[model samples]
Target: EAGVAQSPRYKIIEKRQSVAFWCNPISGHATLYWYQQILGQGPKLLIQFQNNGVVDDSQLPKDRFSAERLKGVDSTLKIQPAKLEDSAVYLCASTGTSGVHEQYFGPGTRLTVT
Candidate 1:
């Protein structure tokens, strides 16, 4: 009974550099989500994946941000030419299939772009 997994729990880079984050959702969980959370603000949904297919990404900044769920399990999020305003916590969460689907969040990757 393990939870979601994310790597490189912290990252720092200069503006204009690129950064990537990884996530592995729980077994059998069909829905996965990536969220961006700025300090003092609630997390904003960046993208969502149901299995290996994308469900939503309208809020994501296409020019600088991208994400994918591979094989319906593992996922990655990348930000290119990072901006100083992109400094925030990137969180990965997953949920089950039941009606009362509870979402589990990973220890976010905090990105600091100088």
Candidate 2:
């Protein structure tokens, strides 16, 4: 099966600018998740989706970050009016429902704010 796919493996943007990232999860996976990982820290869950409906987004910063999983498949995450601290790795992961719930992750989009 194909692993998760993401574009622009690296990005650089200035503060207060807007940037968007895209993701394509593995086919047949029932659950998908997006996470933000800062340097020297573990990935933090930003949003999670089960099919087309969102299961959790408690950690997402609603003021500047927004995400969606339309058609219960592909997903996109956007950061508008970005801040210096917003620089980090945005990861997209997926898991199949029939087995262990461990997730498979993409190489991630690394954003650097200047």
Candidate 3:
């Protein structure tokens, strides 16, 4: 069984630029999530999706951050007019809702806002 998948392991851009990340979850997983991890801090949930529908995104910055799960499978996260504070790692995870919600994380995309 494969874990989650993410693209562009690393990225660097000047502040105010836009950036996007991609993710593909493991097969059979029913839920997917996007998280932002700042250095020295635990990951913060940015959004969650159950199949192709959005389940949660209250923590996501509506001004510049957006995400979507397509056909209940692949997902994408985008940040426009990114600020310097947006420099962090974007992680993707997936899990089944059968009893445990133990999520499997992907190799995250590291974004550097200069």
lDDT at residue 16 of model 2 (Cα atoms): 94
| Residue lDDT tens for model 1, 39-82 | 99999999999998999999999999999887899899999989
lDDT tens readout by residue for model 3, 1-114: 788999999999999899999999999888999999999999999999999998999999999999988789999999999999999999999998699768899999999999
lDDT of 2 by residue, 1-114 (tens): 789998779999999999999999999887889999999999999999998789999999999999988889989999998999999999999997786779999999999989
Candidate 3 — which pairs collide? none
Clash count for candidate 3 is 0
Model 2 stretches astray by more than 4 angstroms = none
C-alpha TM-score for every candidate: 0.96, 0.96, 0.96
Candidate 3: regions farther than 4 A off: none
Question: Could you tell me which 10 consecutive residues in candidate 1 have the lowest summed lDDT?
Answer: 95-104
Better of 2 and 3 by lDDT: 3
